[model samples]
Target: MASAFELTRNMTIGQYIPTDSAVHRFDPRFKLVAFGVLVLAIAFCNTYVGNLFALAFCLALFPLIRIPVGYGVSGIKPAVPFIIIIALLQFFFSGSIAPGGTLHFEYGVIRITGDSIRLVIVSAMRFVEVIFLSSVLTFSTSTTDLTRGMECLLSPLEKVKFPVHAFALVLTIAIRFVPTFAMEMEKLMKAQASRGAEFGSGEWWRIIRRTKDMFPLIIPLFNLALTRAEDLILAMESRGYVPGEERSVYTRYRSKGADWGLLGISLALAAVILWLP
Candidate 1:
């Protein structure tokens, strides 16, 4: 039962893996922009070959960043079921097929067509590409760097009276709390298991029972999150923190030649992929 907690160890989307590699050393602002471009390219990809190219580009980043391929892919494990479900739904009901297209299966009004199958495949590829690219960014960058990057990237919005710092702070806090909450959930699960609560006992009604049982977990998790948030607020207040106040950054980010080269490559890749026929 304790081994179940180990599963959360691979949930690496919000966790940072520290390494000394060019990807890790790149300015976070440039990385953010490049990642945004990659995501757009993936989303707008129209052909199977284009999606495959996008996926290969994402996969190549793992070695370039010195992160293990397994670690880069681990984040997608937990999302497999959801991805499959979405793919199935799209396949069955997307209506992408033209009239008189080949039908693979049919039951009443539900039908699967070759075009729908292609759509699902492309959609799944897009999902994997986006998730993997995001994992690459998070794994390579620390929370502090991410916050600073976001702040700098959005600084231009301050000219319009936007609360840039506050917004960035909130985003950073939200991301920073992901692993904390995962740990908290693991602890809660272990505690409940000690009290003889059986979760997923392989019984037929196990799914239903587990669903109902989750309410107990949900309430406590919410309370714990709120408590943590309150503590953080108090700590910040005691330290003379004020929202939307000017603060001096301890570290400055400078874009190097390598960073510019990486950004240029990313832009060129995006343009080429988007231009694919």
Candidate 2:
């Protein structure tokens, strides 16, 4: 039961799902750059072929990584409805930037909003791609590896008054807790379900009743978050943390030749996506 639910809810976000596929052996740094590039490229596609190509590329990745394409697609089920609504809005939007944002379209008693349609579709598509790509990376690479890679990428920020080490620590904490929080919420849902709490079959006023029903679930989750935060802070301090101080990392960062090669490939794909459209 736990494993199946794990398949459903968390899906190894920020945790590695071990497989014998080529993707598993690739450097996390390479995956990170590839993931980010794929996002920008997918967003830039204005033509159907471009979108199809991007989709195909992403799907092709599943087999290479031995993570079923269906699983990756299914992960986005919760977000599809929002994507559809945004796409529809985008299809009706009106206006161009060059024309001082004049009313671009008018129908009897109705005018389409400027920059609405394309923006929404683009936004929704971009959102979906980014989410899936992140999932792919998480499913392929260990959370620790991803964190180390992020620290290296973000290291440049140290020159501009950013505490890169602290940033990495915070990111690491957030990633670590995603599954914990997911599990807690799942328990809340199931507990309500066991009590025969029907989330559906309610009237307009029933909305309030349903919301009130969530209180038992909400309070516990809030408490859990606070408790976890306190525990995390204590753990950090116990390890001799000093505020605003940099320290040597327990982990070392290294990028090999293979990592660089993959990084180049990721960049090339991104360039093709943007430069084409």
Candidate 3:
């Protein structure tokens, strides 16, 4: 396919879709905390029922947040191949260390067992849930909101002279540039194709050829990323931005009762999920 490098369509991580839903109206700080709690819960959960419940809970947020189910999950398109590889790897290789799963198949260096299969499926489910939940967060929150929320949440560390604002700024910028970089890569791929360079001609499952084809993109992509970062630095400097300087808040966020209620619900949900078998 000629659209191998068309990453923006599959990248929903940094893309924001504005909506007036209650979830969007909630304080970003609360949202971040709740998201973190849910992430930890998802990471700790290993049972099928637990993961399914988590997945369902995350999916339920789509309607609540006014994000189309299809659009919310579009990001999974590009990740499917990698997920398949990981699932295959775990299914084939993990049986060797599994304690007592029923054996399904065996070969000299390959084996399949109930435990291995469960591991693969559970891992994939976790990946999907995390990705979808993340998409929900970024889709609702703007870049400035994310940065401000993170800084506010981490402000306690400033007592230890931690650079909370700087760290938040760096993290936010990194997240916000994901879509930007994807589009830039797409442009570069088109440019190279215009110059008679071959790309995306190999079959998707042909890992070796695909990898080889992508080799030419790494250096130029990195160079362009750096240039973009430099441009950002110059722009910030031009605007008199100073890291670690005391800055006045242009907008102060006060948590509402609904924000607290949502946070409590998140904590409760996490506890319930973690308690699941």
Best prediction by TM-score? 3
Q: After superposition, how far is residue 93 of candidate 1 from its true place, in Å?
A: 1.9
Ranking, TM-score, top scorer first: 3, 1, 2
TM-score against native, each model: 0.89, 0.76, 0.93
Model 1 lDDT tens row, 112-209: 89888888899999999988887888889898898899999999998999988888888888877877888888888878878987654544333456
lDDT for 152 (candidate 1):
97
lDDT of each: 0.82, 0.68, 0.89
lDDT per residue (tens digit) for residues 190-263 in model 3: 98889988888877887778778778989999999999999999999999998778988888999899999989
1 or 2, greater by lDDT: 1
Candidate 2 clashes between residue pairs 3 or more apart in a chain or in different chains = 90-116, 90-117, 91-117, 94-113, 94-114
Tell me the TM-score of model 2: 0.76
Clashing pairs in 3: none
Which TM-score value belongs to model 1? 0.89
The per-prediction CA RMSD against the true structure, in angstroms, equals 2.6, 4.7, 1.9
Residue-by-residue lDDT tens digits, candidate 2, 1-277 = 2332242453445545898667788777677777777777786676545665566677677777888777777766545545665676555643334355546667764455555554665576666666677777877877677777787888889889888767876887687677678777777667666787654345433445646765777888889899889987899799998978766667675667888888788788777666654
